[model samples]
Target: MSRALKATAIRLTSASALAVTVLTAVGAAPASASTLTDGISATARAENGNGACAHGGYVGGPNQSSSCYGGTTTAHAWCADFAGWVWARNGVTGLSTLDDRAASFMDYGKKYGTISNTPHVGDAVVYNYNGSDYADHVALVTAVSGGTVTITGGNQGARPGHVSTNATSSYSVGSLPWGQRISGYVSPAGSNTPSLPNPASLPAGTLVKSPNGPDVKVIINGAGIPVAASDVTPDKYDLSKIVLVDDTAFRALPSAPASGTVVHDQAGGANRYVVIDGTALLIGAEDWTAAGYNDRADMGVPTAWLQNAAQRQLTTGIVVMDQTGKDPKRYVMVDGAALYISGSEWTADEYNTQTLMGVPGEWLKAAAKKVPSTGTVLMDQSGTDPSRYVMLNGAAVHISAAEWTANGYDKRSLMGVPGGWLASTVSAQVSNGTIVKDASGANATVYVMAGGVAVPLSYADFTGFGYDKRPLEGAPGEWLVSAAAKAAPADGTMLLSPDSNTVWQVVGGKKKAMTADQFGEGKLSFNDVVGVPTAFTAKFPTV
Candidate 1:
């Protein structure tokens, strides 16, 4: 229920009494019982239409700095502005000072070390996307009951309603739900006990310089100095989530923690990373001189340096296979592990001439079979796909390879036996296989798909372009059924794949790909042709 602000008489209390109440509520003192709680509710000016938003204009309209607490330059989707105003009025120092975007609460929580999973009245709950810096939405906790909490937030409805309590959806405080979208709640001032250890107190390998100065540009390599330079760590924190036809990169972060003062257990190893100076450094490697202090080499940011709780859950125990070469003898890695082929096991002469019965898919399955244990064979990629393969050790694992996981590859310690298995979910992945035909053979502009995602095969590269590409040998179920066999959809009607997960539409008698998320976008609109189209069977290339 939401409403516009209505003036009402409030009971008057002494200044000292008001101060005591706020402090008591924040501290939840010993005198206050926790078990038999009265429960907390909104204490801010969160009443609907209560703030200046009633008088404020729309987004891109004139800025009413005086009325809107200078939260936004101009009136635009003022959910955050309204929230900021309420917090500021309640003397929430951080919200009042940095009230601009709805996501500003995330930064506020990080800076003051006031973020919590446990719900409390007057706390700000934030929702972030992917690993982004900004939050998508925020609400004020109005009440708490068991696992759920009631929230009062602006822009709760489709029309950007005023502050009201909405309970259609709730988030978890005990554990992560899917992408770890909810960034957690921010406690009001004085109710927090934060422990931010000094650099020397943090784990070794933590990159520390000063409180607010230039990064020493040194890297901590656990207890030992693995050469002061970035010979070991990957560089650039920006990772691409989807790659499109034109080779454009598309990345999205649904929820990421506030980008400051965090600790990550690097891949479950002994090495720990603490965010010092807004940069991630390993613990125990805090010795400045050990980093080649005087002539320290640049240890730039690593890709997605800090893994939040959700990321850690997704990455832990997930295995990916990295294959390079004509046959199994060369190199094959399953979750960073490789079958060691010592010495010149295969000289240039012996390697190229070895007689192999099948394609890379067959070889991959064969190699995986050699492993004692492997996960179900749900996905595979051929040798000639245009996208770069394994930029580093098992790079595909870094990218969100949905199809790989969909193909019975999740929750496994090792790659399963070389055969296909049934999957509960089947997401899309743009196949990097070669097009039916190419001039330079550099790569096919388009690729083909059979059981798994499309890829250019070594044999097909010289055979009949992409037209002759056949379904994989051991593919199970209708996933391997030819796309040509499927009936075209009605002109305007978008159709989900035979798997009931993929979505596409036939326009002017041609196939046009679109985002699968649209299935939950309420209804189809004029811009039904919303996203770019490609032929990954169930998936489209991300740009």
Candidate 2:
């Protein structure tokens, strides 16, 4: 409840005679029981709606001058008079002048230990007059800074009806009325003990800032400095509910969370981020304060805004991706990390590579798939059909000599490992003795599947490519090579001719030589896609 209401309740509870008797008996009471807050509240209410205490017309001072104290005359100093009226309203009796009453009240507080001279919030700051007989100046301290009181007073001199900070002047008492000299302090009633907030009870990393409508800046642990009202989450926080996303790119206080701390996606309009640590996450923000800076948090006017906010560019660990991928584009990053680029702007290399440039559907499917513990695999470049030379783990699946191009390899449909396994048709002769090799005639493994099971390709299973005639050797489920069969092209028998380097052979009876465009668009057989924590095991060998 407000101080005025508390004082009113106190007055109502005691009988009029009893109150007078108590005051009379204890003419000099301690400042401990004094109500300085009550006095200030009463003064604010009186000055708010009525001209009785004309606030000195927005001159930036707390109260009006004495010249305008008596309901508009602007002659008498208004600070003491306002205090006098407040004192009277609080039922303080026998007070003719505000000046004398204020001093007497302070004197009574000092004599009885009811008040102190130190200034605090809601304290009546008494200023002494240099040449006057009595204490002539007073104001209500709304806030205190560096132990100096910012007062709301009136009727001292110029700017007579305004509120100002550290108002000390010639009219001030006990000392020269300068910015920070205090004559004496009057203890306001019920102010000695305040309900302090218990920090230990609050959650660690709790947002401890202003809890009211007016903007408030908070300093946490004397290190994490203030955050503005507009920047901070606009809400009141009690001791019970406070822990929230801290020092992350997306700034927010969550009512309920998935983790002890989960980041916000307010900027990207999507809830996804690469959490650097529990204390920080890389999220897209339209207005990020830490943009292009190391020390994100600071104590000063805020001037930061985010642009190009998105979640696809983030990783879970260290940031390594550059905005531009000129030559060295591919980045090996952790599943979750903050990725930064050299330029102010950058995009994923997968989105711009020449081999995978126009594959939007492939890109989406790859990204949307679950995270893979192992690396990614894409189809080789020379193969006409993506399913022809598939990528099992991170190596090429040697199907047949024709399945691979003469000079270039094929890897078009290689993005996501859906379901953990892939399948493709191979010529039966490939199971016989026939091997594919690099441009330098170096033998390369050719993977082949029989009985719907995958196997590694090795020279022991099939003869090296360009060999004339070989016989079949292994069973359908086992890795084996046979002797040379009829050396004729059949269904799905890919043949990479030594003549034209850039051509694919995919036909029933006749072979067709297709261009690069025709080669990349071929069909793919995605067997399965797997997320993390899944295993990939196979037991066949292809040579």
Quick one: best lDDT, which candidate?
1
TM-score of each: 0.25, 0.29
Clashes of each: 39, 91
lDDT of 2 by residue, 1-543 (tens): 111211111010112222100111223332332234534443444453333245432111122124353455444334555554444434343333233223444453444444443555555655432212334346565544563445554443343343233432232233334442345555444322333344333433344532211222232222222334444443233334433211211112221221112233322334322222222233334223223222222212111111121223333322233222222332222232111222212232232232211111222233333232222233322233445333322232433545345423444224322111222212212321122222223423343332222333344333333232332222211122221122223344333323335333434444454445543335421121111100111111111
**What lDDT would candidate 2 get against the real structure?**
0.32
Computed on alpha carbons, the lDDT of every model, listed in order, comes to 0.35, 0.32
Query: lDDT value for candidate 1?
Result: 0.35
**For model 1, how does the per-residue alpha-carbon lDDT over 191-231 read when each residue is reduced to its tens digit?**
21122223323343444332111223212322111122332
- What's the lDDT for residue 171 in model 1? 59
